[model samples]
Target: MTTIARVETFLVAPRWLFVRVETDDGIVGWGEATCEGRSETVRTAVEQLSELLIGRDALRIEDHWQVLTKASFYRGGPILASAVSGLDQALWDIAGKRYGAPVHQLLGGPVRDRIRVYGWVGGDEPDEVRDQIAGRVEAGLTAVKMNASGRMSPLASVAELDAVVRRVAAAREVLGEHRDVAVDFHGRFTLANARRVAPLLEPYRPLFLEEPVVPENSHLIGELVRATTTPVSTGERLYSRQEFLPVLQAGIAVAQPDLAHAGGITEVRKIAALAEVYDVQLAPHCPLGPIALAACLQVGFATPNYLIQEQSIGIHYNLGAEVLDYCVDQQPLSFVDGYVQRLTAPGLGIEIDEQAVRAADKRGHAWRSPTFRHPDGAYAEW
Candidate 1:
């Protein structure tokens, strides 16, 4: 038996943690469990998980998932789920390599040869929305996503409300009729503000209004979705199928599952299956690293209702490093008119540059996501 021999983690630059798993016969697999702004915390969780994984058979992936997840009295959250998710991806990587096929092939073969992907534009909030949209358009991208606001107050004045509408209008000007633009609310809006803003942006026809309210307030999603002609999308914060079921029932037009935090390939595949029944589109939320993007591609290739993918090639969050920086063969992530070609190599397809990863780990980061505050010294969702 090819027992799991070693599990290692490299905390790479620009906020990502790469997981490398090896077997007795020298077969290696890689996965990403990056909980951006919390890489070190997830790293510690992975270290603890390694104790449970070290002597197991690398091929019994499902069994390992069942044990690593359910064996614990408390299971499912960003930390534990993110830890298991990376290992799940690595195990699937090993299985694909063992079978000499792509991960999608092992998941019942490819449903589409290539999947369309959307590029991210703007910083925490868009400063030069038109210029940024133009840049993506010039880069041969047909679709792009941008934050609706940097830090939105519970209710805003006319100036703030007008600015939000203007940002969406600016993107529409760059995209025109053929291309698409998705506006991400980032859960920065209160139900009142979201209700007011969703209607204003309808004339521009955004691909979807993402997370008008946070996942915790998901019971209110249908209110936002029903209020707008534009679609509503969510799920990067959601960790499992159960967390997603109620959201799916809320009439969301699209579902965005992050492969690294949502139970990796094992649970996300089931989540995708559930989304299909509701006629909701799939757009895996991957703003982390290469492995997460590759896993998203694997699911995107096999799933029929997949809408598009979000890759962090040059996303604003990448402070000092880019997604392709860790890829051995960067061509797999090359965009062809905004669409990533289907990966064909065994395992997760793209190779990780371990040397670069280890060197970056030497200068590890303590990345923290930005915090938001109201003028009155109260905490606000970021």
Candidate 2:
């Protein structure tokens, strides 16, 4: 049996975390955990979880996931689930490498030759929406996503409603009707405000309005979805299929499970199939690094109802390091026009530049998302 010899975590730049697993036979696998703004916390979680996995047979990916996920008396929150997610991905990486095939081939077979992907365009205010989208279009991207609004109040006024619609309109003008654009609500809006804003953006025809309300209130997402003519997208905060099932049944039109957060290739594929039963589109949320993106791509290629993928190439959060900065051969992971071509290489497909990862790990990061407050000093969603 190929037993896992060592498991290591690297806290890299721009708030991304990576995991490296090595077997007794000298086979290595890489995976991205990338719990943004909490890299150190997740690093500790990875180390703690590694103690449970180090001596286990590397090929028992499913059994390991069951143990890692359910062994805890209490399980399935972001930190623990995200830790299991990266380890699960690394195990799949090892399994693929051992068999000399990419992960998609190992999971039944590929349903498509290539996967379509989207880039980011960020601005707290809507003024930069048009020019930023134009830049992405000029760079050969056919799709882009932007935050739907800045810090919104529980009860938004008429001006706030118009502002959100205006941003989508600007992107729609740039993208036209044929191309695609997605709007991430970032869970910043209250239920009333989110429902009110959703219909107003329908004229612009966004591919989806993501996470209109926080996942804590996911029971209400169905009400928000039915309240809108546009498709609702969410699931970055959701950690498992149990968490996802209710939202899918809640009538979300698109499911946006992050591979790094939702138990990696193993759980996301299951989530995709569950969504297909509801006729919901699969768009794995991956605004992280290359390994996470590669894992998302493998699932995308095999998923029949996959919509489009979200990548962090040139995204605003990538301050010190970029997506391809840690890649050995960037071309294999490079976007052609808009889609990432199907990866034929064994394992996760991207050759992680170990030296770059190590050097960046040394530098590390103390990244945190900004906090917001209303005028009355009450907390506001960021």
Model 2 residue 271 CA deviation in Å: 0.9
> Which residue runs of candidate 1 sit more than 4 Å off their true CA positions?
123-127
Give the CA lDDT, 0 to 100, for residue 349 in model 2: 85
Q: Single out the weakest 10-residue window by summed lDDT for candidate 2.
A: 122-131
* Residue-wise C-alpha lDDT for candidate 1, range 1-382, written one tens digit per residue: 8799999998888988889999999989999999988878999999999998898899998899888889889888899889899999999999899889999999899999888888888843344888888888888789999888877888878877888898888889878999999989898899889999989999999999988898889889888878878899999999998999998998998999899999999999999999999999999998889999999999888889899999878776788788999888899988898788899999999898888888999998888877889889899888
The local lDDT score (0 to 100) that residue 132 gets in candidate 2 is 90
Residue 344 error, candidate 1, Å: 0.6
